[model samples]
Each structure stands twice: as C-alpha cells, then as structure tokens.
Target: MATTALFFLFAGFAIACAVSMVYHRNPLYSAISLVGVFIALSCIYITLAAPFIAAVQILIYAGAIMVLVVFVIMLLNLEDDKPLNRLRYLYAVGGGLGLILLVQTFFIFYAVMRAPKQTVDADVTVGKTLSIGTAMYTEYLLPVEIVGILLLMAVIGGVILARRLEQPKLELVVDNELERRGEGEIKDEFRIRL
Candidate 1:
C-alpha cells in the first residue's frame, strides 16, 4: 500500500512537472521543470524495482542531459517568449490534447493497478551492466554499427549545413580622370551613353 501510494505520488509529480516543462515560456524554467520530471521518473523507476534504470535516469537524464540543456540554454542566451495571447488557439488545442492524454493515462493506470502481479525468479545476469554491454556488442552489433553510421552522417550533414560560405569581394579601380569626376558628371555621362 505504501509503495503504491509513493508510486502514485511520484507519478503525479512527474506529470505535473512534465506539464510545466511544456507550458513554461522561459527555457530555463522549462529545463528546470524537466529536471524535476526526471527526478520524479527516477523515483518511479526505483519503486518499480529497476534500480539500474533509476540510477541511469539520475546520472544520464537528470544529471548529464540536464547539464547539457542548461549549458545550451545559457550559450544561446534565450529571451522570454511573447505573450500567449497571440497563440490563444494553440493553447486551446494543447489543453484539449492534455485532457485526452489525462483520460488515457487514468484508464491505463487503473488497468495496470487491477492486473494480477506475477513473480519471476531473479536472474543474476538480467540487469547487470556488464551483461547488457555484452549483449549490445555481440547480439546487437549490426544495429549498433548502423546507428553509429547514421549518427556520423547526421553530424557530417549538420557541419556541412552550419558552415558559412565566403562571399566574393567586389573592387572597382577607377582611372585618374574618373577619380576626379564628380558624382553628377558621372551620372550625366552614363545617361548620355544610355
């Protein structure tokens, strides 16, 4: 009962933080809310007895990913967004979608809560980091290599797209006569030629 209560509490907090993260106009505030959501998700993972996933959630998502997001936010020096009045219709759409998601979540949670719980014999190698690494390298090697190649291509594409092309400079060299000529005289000469 206590575990279930704690799970629900964390889940609710996670959902609230996620909503705040999406709705906040300020990037920094949104990132901070995302951290809260990650923390809440980690707590939920712990309650589910997946300590490895919980630790990864804290270390990778909450710590490393959040730090990267904050650093990018700081580097970009983002300003506060404009008032939502201009996007009032978007707000209505978002609110309707949020309501639909909430209903779906409630139904899903209710179904999960009512389902029969099954116990499995814990395997020594099941959740170990080493076993996971081994499996990835051995069984999933081809997919991993493909993903790496795709990422490399994406990086190359990004670099190519981001590079700035140098514009050719235009220089005009005038003779002594032309240099001495006034702007009105030059215009008169061009008009006569035309």
Candidate 2:
C-alpha cells in the first residue's frame, strides 16, 4: 500500500514537473524542472520494484544528461525568450493537438483498465539487470559496439569543434617608442570571446 502511494506521489510530481518544464520561458528553469521530473521518475521506478531502472534514471538521465544540458544552457548564456504575437495561430494548433492527445490518452486508459491479465510469466527475468546485461553481451553485442564507436566519434568531433571555436585572436600592443616592422607588438595571450 505504501509503495503504491509512493508511486502515485512521484508520478504526480513527475507530471507536474513536466508541465512546469514546458510552461517555463527561461531555458535554465525548464532544465531545472526537467531534472525534477527525472528525479520524480527515478522515485517512481523505485516504487515499481525496478531499482536498476531507477539507478539508471538518476545516474544517466538526471545526473549525466541534465548536467550536459545545463552546461550547454549556461555556455550559451540564454535569456528569456520574447513571446511573439504572430505565433498565436501556432499556439492554437498546438492546443488542438494537445486536446486530441488528451482524449486519446483517456480512451487508451479505459481500454487498458478493462484489458485481460498478462499471458506472460509473472516471474520473468526479462526485466532483471543481470539478464538484460547478459542479453546485451550475448545477443546485442554488435549493435552495442557500433553505438559505442559512434559515441566516441561524436566526442572527438565535439572536441575538434570546441577547439576551433576558441581560436586565439591577435591584438596589437604597440609601444610608442618602438620602431616599425617590430613583430613583438602582437599579443596572442588574452582571448576575449563574447
């Protein structure tokens, strides 16, 4: 009973945070709200007897991914976006789409509530971390390796791009008493990137 209550609590909090994340104008606030949503989802996973998923939720999504997102936001130095008046039609269309989704969600929930019991075994090992890890190593090894290589390539590309973006600009520090054709007047030490 307590577990079920906790699950609902976290689920509700996650929903609320998701809404807040979408509603916020500031990117940083939205990112913070998304972190809250991730944590709440982690708690929900714990209540559902999926500690491995919960740990991943916290470690990967909340910890690593959110850190990257927040770092990028800070790096960009984002400001609150100004609301445009011409986008009202787009807002209306989005609201209509959201209404359709809400109705579809209700229908799906109703169908799910009246559905038959599971045909699969209750004591299945499919959800277990050990079983999943074993399957990844045995069956999905090639795909996993491919993904790892892709991620490595992405990281290398990102490093190259960052270095290129931080190229040093030379500034003239000419001495009044110095003669022409002097090469020591150029200073490349101070880098001002705005």
Candidate 3:
C-alpha cells in the first residue's frame, strides 16, 4: 500500500511537471520544469526498485543534461517568442486527444491493478553495473557505438552553427531597382531586404 501510494505520488508529480514544462512560456522555465519531471521520474524508478536507473536518471539526465540545457539557453540568450494565443486553434483540437489519453491511462492502471504479481527469476542477474557494462560492450556494442557517433555529429553540428558568422550583404536600391552589393562594400541602403 505504501509503495502504491508512493508510485501514484511520483507519477502525479511527474505528470504535473511535464504539463508545466509544456505550458511555460520561457525556455528556462520549461527547462526547469523538465528537471522537476526528471526528478519525479527518478523517484518513480526508486519506487519500482530500480536503484541504478534512478541514480542514472538523477545524475545524467536531471543533473548533467539539465545543466547543459540551461547553460545553453543562457548562453544563447533565448527569449519567449509570441504568445500562445496564436495556437489557440490547436488547443481546441488537442483537447479531444487529451481526453483519449486520460481514458487510456485509466484503463492501463485498472489492468495493472487486476494483474497477478510475478516472481523474479533468481537465476537472472539484473541491475548490476558489471552485468550491464558487459552486456553493453558485448551484445549492444554496435548500437552504443552508433549512438556515440550520432551524439558526436550533433555536437559538431552545434559548433558549426555557433561559429557561422554570415553577415548578410545589404541589397542596394539604386534607381528603385534592387542591386546585390559585395559583402565588403558598405552601402547606404539601411533597409535590409529580408
């Protein structure tokens, strides 16, 4: 009963955080909400008796990755775009989907409550760092290598985008006709033809 209550508590907290993350206007606030969601998920993992996954969820996702995301948001000096009223139509459509999801969640919980508990196999080693590392290196080596490569590529792409200093050459309006000026040339056409 205690475990079930804890699970529900963390699950509700996680859902609230997720909704807050989506509802926030500011990127930083959204990111902070996401951190809360991650922490709640860590608590859920704890309730499920997965200490290793819980620790990883807190350390890697909640700690390191959130810090990076917040740092990047600060570094880029991001601001909230337009208000959400522009997407009011989408919300009306999404309400139906949200109702469906709620019903599905209720049915899932009902099924879980009615399901029989299964005994863990004593022969199978689970949640050990050594066993996980062995499996990652032996069985999932290619997939792990591929993920690493993808992450590396993403980092490289981010660096390239950050270093791009493309100064747009001002379009010169000579005789009411647009003329492409050289990048080095400084013309009096202050109106940037965007």
Candidate 4:
C-alpha cells in the first residue's frame, strides 16, 4: 500500500512537471520543470525495482541532457515570440489530448487494480546493469557505435557552424583640403581597410 501510494505520488508529480514544462513561457522555467519531470521519472524507476535505470535516468537525462539543454537555452538567449492568443488552438488540441490520456490512464489503473497479483520470476536479471551492458556490447554494439559516431559528427558540425567568419575592417578617411576649409566631415570617404 505504501509503495503504491508512493508510485502514485511520483507519477502525479511527473505529470505536473511535464505540464509545467510545456506550459511555461520562459525557456529556463520549462527546462527546470523538465528536470523535475526527469527526477520524478527516476523516482518511479526506483519504485519499479530498477535501480540501475533510475541512476542512469538521474545521471544521463537529469544531469547531462538537462545541462546541455540549459546551456543551449542560455547560448541562444531566446524570448517568447508568439502571443498566448495565437496559440489558443494549439492549447485547445493539447488539452483535449491530455483529457483523453487521463481517462485512458484512469481505466488502465482501475483494470490493473482489479487484476490478480502475479509472482515475479526470481531468475530474471533484466534490469541488472551487468546484464544490460553485456546485451549492449554483444547484441547492440553496431547501433551503439553508430550513435556514438553520429554524436561525434554532430559536435564537429556544431563547432564548424559556430565558428566566426573574419571580415575586413572599415576605415574612415578625411581629406586634408577639407580639413583646411573647415569641412573635415568624411562624407562617402569610408572604405575597407585592407
């Protein structure tokens, strides 16, 4: 009963944080809410007896990914572009979808509660980090290496794109005759200083 209650609490918190992440106008606030969602998800994973997954969720998604997102947000320095009224239709559609999902979740939980409990297999080693690592290295090595290479390429591309281009400086020139005549204004006399 206590575990069930804790699961519901974390689930609700995750949902609320997800909603806040979507609804918040400020990007920083949205990112922070997303971090909260990640934490709540980590808690849920812990309750599911997957401590390795929970730790990875906290370390990878909550730690590395969120830090990258926040860094991007700060680097871009974005502002709210669209007015609330402009997104009214989007909000309506999202709300409708959320309502449908809530109803579905309610029915699913009710059905689960009505179902008979089953014993968990003691021989299952699915959630263990060692088993997962073995599977990844043996079965999914190629895909993992491909993803790593893609990430490396993306980093290289980002660096290349962010590099600043060098431009020639502009120089202002004044005529000595104009200076002697008290008309020293350098009108149309500016040129690129090579």
The lDDT leader among the candidates is 4
Over 83-182, each residue of candidate 2 has an lDDT whose tens digit, in order, gives 8787689988999999999999999999999999666543453555887788899999999999999999999998898875543433222322232545
Which pairs of residues clash in candidate 1, taking residues 3 or more apart in a chain or in different chains? none
- For residues 47-117, write the lDDT of model 1, one tens digit per residue: 76667778988999988979989999999999987776676799789889989988999999999999999
The estimated TM-scores of all candidates read 0.65, 0.74, 0.66, 0.67
Model 2 TM-score on a 0 to 1 scale: 0.74
Model 1 TM-score, all chains together? 0.65
Q: What's model 2's lDDT at 134?
A: 89
Candidate 4: the clashing residue pairs are none
lDDT of 4 by residue, 88-178 (tens): 7997898899899999999999999999998765336466687788988999999999999999999999999998756433332334455
Q: Who is ahead in TM-score, 1 or 2?
A: 2
* Model 3, TM vs. native: 0.66
Candidate 3's residue-wise lDDT over 82-151, tens digit each?
A: 6676779998789989999999999999999999998765334455466678889999999999999999
* Evaluation by TM-score, superior candidate among 3 and 4: 4
How does candidate 1 score on lDDT?
Answer: 0.81
Clashes of 1: 0
Model 4 TM-score relative to the real fold: 0.67
2 or 4, greater by TM-score: 2
